[model samples]
Target: MPDECVILADGPAALVELCGISTLERLLRTLQRCGITRAIILSSSAAEIARRLARPSWARADLEFTIHERPPGPTTVQQIVDLWPEAAARLLLIQGDVVFDIRLLRTLLAQTSSAMLIDSSAPETNRGKLCGAALLQREWAVARNGSVESALLEGLEQHTAEALDVANQPLYDPGLRRNLRPICFPAPALANKQAAERVLFDSVQKGTLDFPAWIHAPIEKFLLRYLCRTSITPNQLTISWAIAACLTTIFFATGHLIWGIVLALVVGILDGLDGKQARLKVETTAGGKIEHHLDSFFDVVWPIALAFHFYSSGRLPTAFYYLVVLLAGEGVDGIAKAIIYSGAGRLMTRSICATHRRPAKYLHLGVGHRADSWSAGKGSNCDGVVGIDDCCNRHSASSTDVDLAPKNTLVDQLTINPVGLVLGCADRFDEAVYHNVVFERHAELALEAAAYALFHYLQNKRLGNAGAAILSQNAERNETHCANFATIVEQLD
Candidate 1:
């Protein structure tokens, strides 16, 4: 059996952009995450793609990418057989346009013979879609000459084969008959500007912990669509927002409360953009780290600035109390994060041990500690959303593994405090945390602005009544939103 996986990247689907990244890049990253170090990409624009992948961000030192000019008038299977006969028996075939769970690929790779994944729960029109992925034996691929769907069907008729039903698995195939659906795609149609905007809005993380940012998601999506088209980097967006946040600090310090509040909201929107842009453009680890550090600095400064504003307004008692609460709340949140990380480390250790013991079954799963250097040491912080390695790490412990056997110390620890596990290691947890931390802080800032206005009004009605009324109204809305966010977080826990 040949060791190389074959990716078909010649179709229109490969050009489609989902959540800011090209479908082809997503496919390549997925393969790398599965420990596939060699891949043969069949693309019509092979030269262009090869140039793009030469960049450090897309190129992997461990992975050797071979681009074959896709031949016209021949289907993917036939083209592969004609060009790469040596890989006939051992090819993992994947369509460039679709986004599928890594778990499905792991399952397919474990199969010894030709097999195809079918979504049993897909709409009737999509019944034979094959999800645009298959495990092809060299003999089978060479013997057929049609669409992958037709070839798979013919192979099934000719020989005994495995047709794994992955209807329950997450899949995002734009070629399917049905319209967009589910959290799997994370987007809608990516056909045009209007459609892309809808895709961005739809792609916003919608998990329980994401409730805090749900309100601003639409506006963020609007900004994201435009940002995606520009050469503006994620670091640029982060720096721009940081400047705005600094201006906001000046406004509050100078008693220009309304302007401060408005600028703060702008900062919030821009804050949301940086990460969205990063994920969309497939930015480097250094870019993300820069954004996080800048964000952390401002996260501390904003509250301190607000406390100063309150102090200067002759509300010493209120200012001190607010400062204490804000500081304490942040401290507690930090501790919670630390605990979650510690728990995740424990879970990962156990999972790695189990993986080593049953190497074959877990081969396509976690890459263990060695994965840390695969993508510039970003694997250690595998947020599970952006990087492919992280995504695999998130799902490394399969459902069967979770269900089996001995209730060890690690299992007992997880059972006793599932909050850490869910918050730290779940597939969507990092996304939830990314959006929630920014918007949640914005929510708290809104409340602080409202409190400042109310206190100012009480100190001098003539000077503050109008601002107080507006701020109070906005605060009420934000407070209600915060309450809803709290409820969702509680439910997640």
Candidate 2:
């Protein structure tokens, strides 16, 4: 592989219902126009649905347009890495639902430096509403991990002033991502009004969209003016969006039906402005990553709270439906974001950040499969996703597992969700704080919550089919590594 960029297609459902044939065709056209050849697509069980219903010519070539079926329940995102560690490295990862202009994607990649595709039209109310997209350079593929989503989450959790204590101490800390170029790609609304209208129309025609057609059209005059206000930084606006989303959750939980819909609309619009702010000001920094983290947090927590509220109000059935939509949307996008970031993080951390430093020895066990030929620098820990020191020749069958497991107690304690255990520590933060007391507190609480969720689901038998259930179990198991992240941070405190 000549260091290809990966494009992640989240799942089958988003592919068919969200993008439809026309939108998907448009995206393909854009990709072709932009000169991007190799990419990856993350598919779900519904992938078969899209293939059966709206079959496309590109999909016929399974080798080129690879669709990694999302695993059951929580396992959806991790499955991409668990299954295809090789392709995970070189990909222009993208989700199914998010529709971006091919021109913008090209513009994003042209930066040569680190760049993110920010939705300039993302409204303040909707700024952190969804996962923002980014364009990764070839060098980023160096720090590859099975789950790019986990990598960023790890970054966010470790984003404090004291995170630098582990540097040069047998620890790898890609100093909190500070300055990456953010290419402000105007949203469909601002870039192409007609395309934006068509997207909304398509959603309505499919009946998959709950909001009205006007929501996707050009921004309202007042909203535009509000965004132009001088005092707001994009991060503050994003946090405000989080607060609004939190409010929406509270309203939904309280049985405020009409208000919930209105709030959802508000959230959607608010999310439109984030990219705009970044573009207008040309502001990209470590602080921006913090905003991105806030956006992801609200995406997860808000809908979850709403679902719980509806369930508590005796509309368990309806709540389940909403819950599924929320989870599916977030889960699929989360996976895509992970795939995209993994490629980006690799270049930034390895070649850009670590290029000047001499390779040092670090001890850690290997979980998933290791690359037979490809490997990272000496004593470097290559997580299943990226950071390879050697090349993997797919033709060879050197499948024997390696066991240079670390003797560190904390290393042993690290468990992965949807998989079993996360073996390698990406940064020294894992050693210094992840195993400390503050982290212990968050870990205990998160574990309790995970246990409770498992018990509830099992009792209700919400695992759906056997495959889904098995995958769900695997995902939950793997998530223990990610879920305990907060606790790890508390340890630093």
Identify the leading candidate in terms of lDDT. 1
lDDT of 1 at 264: 87
Provide TM-scores for the models.
Answer: 0.54, 0.28
lDDT accuracy of residue 106 in candidate 1: 56
Candidate 1 per-residue lDDT, tens place, 115-151, comes to 7766656533334435667776666666677676667
Q: What tens-digit string does per-residue lDDT give for candidate 2 at 331-372? A: 898799777654442233233221222222121112322222
Assess each prediction's global lDDT (C-alpha) against the native.
0.50, 0.38
Regions of model 2 farther than 4 Å from truth = 5-7, 10-13, 16-22, 46-63, 74-90, 120-132, 136-150, 153-493
TM-score top scorer: 1
